[model samples]
Target: MSGFASWIGGALGWTLGGPIGAAIGFAIGAAVDKATSKGLLLEPPKRGSQQRRKRVDPVYEKRRRRKTVREKQAQTKSGDFEVSLLVLSAIVMKVDGEVSESEKDFVRNYFTKMYGKQRANHAFKLFNGLLKKEDISTRQICQQIQMYMDHSSRLQLLHYLFGVTKADGHVDESEVDLIEKIAGYLYINDRDFQSIKAMFYNPVDSAYKILEIDKSATNNEIKKAYRKMAKKFHPDKLEHLGEEHMKGANEKFQKVQKAYEQLQKERGF
Candidate 1:
């Protein structure tokens, strides 16, 4: 149990149920077949009617394996973020008519940047299969995520989604509507939604939006907002999701910092 099987272990424990499981079943099966062929995962020989199933740590191998060097870290089923991303990416990419090459590249490049080429290839391959099924229910899939995923990871998911929506140069109105609805289903408040949304689509007051504050906010209010937003979007909040996910979390966190810095510079605070 290594490569793909290790990734599968997370789904087996968490997301391999309800709408999410139904949605990605084929893609996961296909990925398993490919991983098996690569000999990264060995199928144990069956004993009589009892099947031999190998059990691996639930996280994708990189994070779990790397964490072994550290002691007393919480480790358990972990692929919830990866699996959820695949389903949500398919939904976001396909929402605006056909999936654009730009959106595909955004996802592929992001995965490669975060997970390295080999694992990124595995993710994109599975994601392609998911894109084939265009009828995924966002509400149901989001419901599953909201119920099982931690709030910080959920925010990261929304951030990735907004990134996908903006990947094709311009964000479509339909995609915005759908993603907004998705935020609601994921239980994200409007302010948090706007904060993440502003990262991708910017206007004059975009920094204020990123801080979830209005233009008329007092200096003290702005300071509070900056501190609150900083805590909300901090990369450390997503540390449990592993180092790979920290890239996206850091992106959001930096936006919060930039927003704060802009306000600080403008008001001479």
Candidate 2:
């Protein structure tokens, strides 16, 4: 029998019986074959006589190596996203010219929920490293955030940032300035930012009252109002009004958008 076939049979026999029985079986088989072939008896094979064949499945090995590399890449991407989010979040929290305990708690809870305890701790370490650097510009950080995250995610991130600033139950001027910078970087027009803020921050009764629209406004009407207000307060249109007036107009435009969105959500539009 071939070496491989012999090894397979011996292993099977050893499993069924014991070492001595396997040895005896192998010896009898070898002797019978030798006697029949050359009129000579043969002894049993040694336990360590066979050398195991090396694994030759190159395809499988390559696949395993590639999987390891992909896993490492995924880990790196996750780390980068976490670091960027933490730094930008921190900057927003500190923008209102203060970082309250509530703001800190919001940040901590956010990190913990997203990354778990261990990774969240590591993210905090990264955050400290970035914060310690004196040359980091808030505008640059906002731009980086915009570049990395997608449009919808950027909006949600800005919402979370707003939540952090409002955690202390007040929106400070610094926080507003920080959010404005982020909105600019994200290319979220002043109107859109205000629209988001109104949806989240405005009281239900006051929002409906300010919009002068009913909870049951048709989708068409809602769209009409949004477009009309968008055109009226678009920063581009107000450029001739000078920077001071344009700034205030942009802020008001944002408020209009926020109110419209809030009303739309309430009416299920």
Query: What's the residue-level lDDT of 50 in candidate 1?
Result: 78
What is the per-residue lDDT of model 2 for residues 226-267, given as tens digits with 9 covering 90 to 100? 777566556665343234234434555676677678767866
CA displacement after TM-score superposition, residue 209 of candidate 1 (Å): 1.1
**Per-structure clash totals for the candidates:** 0, 5
When summed lDDT is taken over every stretch of 10 residues in candidate 1, the lowest stretch is 69-78
Count residue pairs with overlapping backbones in model 1: 0
Native-structure RMSD, model 1? 8.5
Can you list the residue pairs that collide in candidate 2?
95-174, 96-175, 194-254, 195-257, 195-258
